[model samples]
Target: MLVKYRGSYEKVAMGLLSFIPDLKDLNNLTNEMTLYQKDESHVLYLWKNKDNDFSGVVGVEVADKYIVVRQISLIPSERGTGNSLEILDELHQLYPDQNMMGSFDTTKLVAKWTEHNRHLNTEV
Candidate 1:
């Protein structure tokens, strides 16, 4: 199941960094989250396993009538199982009227997956 994440989910969110080597530092993640939260510009949701284990997080920033996906990360153990797509679908359903955009490093595997699943342009 997916749930809104509060400050307590910080650790689990930080743990997800292992999947993205360039973002292995918790301090950087914390700083970004803190800034976003303080600015009231971001909302985060987490997907939990049946036992309530943290599986992944989807971060979105609202911009006018659209929602820009800042990041979506799944733990290594949960990769390739369609959990990320499930999360994206839930977010889309929750805000059906809003345009959703997901951004990622163009060189990463995530960029390829996002383009395939969301049908977004690779050049962006």
Candidate 2:
């Protein structure tokens, strides 16, 4: 499940975001969070797994025609478990009318999810 980021989740969000290499630095992480909080176009979400634990974080920039995934990270235990795909799926549900894209860092992850979704739809 995707939980829209709130001020209360700052620590959790930062912790998850730190999993991303580029955001490991405290300064960069703080700036990134500020961008999400200050800019209406950019939004952040926390992923709550089936056990009801927050284990992932995704940041996106919402445009008129598409949502660009800026960053996505999951704890080591959750990596390679298809949870990232699920996070993207929920984002798609939230903005069904818009296409999904990704930033330089997350382009491949978004592409993989898009292809996977396309394959699923074609099979249906």
Candidate 3:
């Protein structure tokens, strides 16, 4: 089971930044998602398991009507179980009404798997 909810970027940013301080910009980056929730300009989704375990997050930024998947991450334990792809799929389904554009980063083996499964470009 997956749950989707509207949340404050401050809370998410605080939690994520504690782990990656360099991601401080994420706090501000998510602002667009917060403000334009219905415009499809940007959106953020946090993923949790059926057991309510926090898994990861995916964020997309829309520019020039292009949906750029800006970030996606899963906790260590959930990495190999296909939860990440499920999250991505959920996001895609959520915004099926839009035309999206983005490339997956394939430098990491896990990224390659995600790209292959999702059928998205992995050069980035």
Candidate 4:
């Protein structure tokens, strides 16, 4: 499930975000988190696993017509297990009105997810 990030999840969010290469640096990680916290258009969501533990983090920038996926990172154990796709699917459902796009970092994964959904819709 997707949970809106809160100050209490700082450590967890940072840890999960660190799994992403660009955010592995402490300074960049801190700044990114700060941006999400301070900017209304930038938002962060934590993925709570079935066991109720946070296993991933997704960051997005909401613009007038698009929700741009900025970052997505899952714990090593959850990688390649469809959790990332699930997170994207949930995000789409959450903001059905706005179009979903990807930032430089997440473009490929977002494209894959979009293609997957497109294929599913055409499978009838």
Scored by lDDT, the top model is 2
Q: For residues 3-97, write the lDDT of model 2, one tens digit per residue.
A: 99999999999999999999999999999999999999999999999999999999999999999999999999999999999999999999999
Count backbone overlaps in model 3.
Answer: 1
Q: Cα lDDT of all candidates, in order?
A: 0.70, 0.95, 0.56, 0.93
* Candidate 4 or 2, higher TM-score: 2
lDDT of 1 by residue, 1-124 (tens): 6677677877776676435555666667667667656767688777886567888877788777888777777877888887776777788777778877766642253444456765655445
Off by over 4 Å in 3: 1-9, 17-40, 63-66, 103-124
Residue 83, candidate 4: alpha-carbon lDDT: 93
Clashing pairs in 3: 105-124
Ranking by lDDT: 2, 4, 1, 3
Residue 114, candidate 4: C-alpha displacement in angstroms: 0.8
Reference-based TM-score, model 1: 0.74
Q: What does the lDDT read for residue 48 in candidate 3?
A: 80
In order of appearance, the predictions have TM-scores of 0.74, 0.97, 0.57, 0.96
- Candidate 1: minimum summed lDDT over ten consecutive residues — where? 105-114
Clashes of 2: 0
Which of the predicted structures, 2 or 3, would earn the higher lDDT when compared with the native?
A: 2
Inter-residue clash pairs, candidate 2: none
Q: How far is 87's C-alpha from truth in model 1 (Å)? A: 0.6
TM-score leaderboard ranking:
2, 4, 1, 3
Error of 4 at 26 (Å): 1.2
Q: Can you give the lDDT of residue 11 in candidate 3?
A: 60
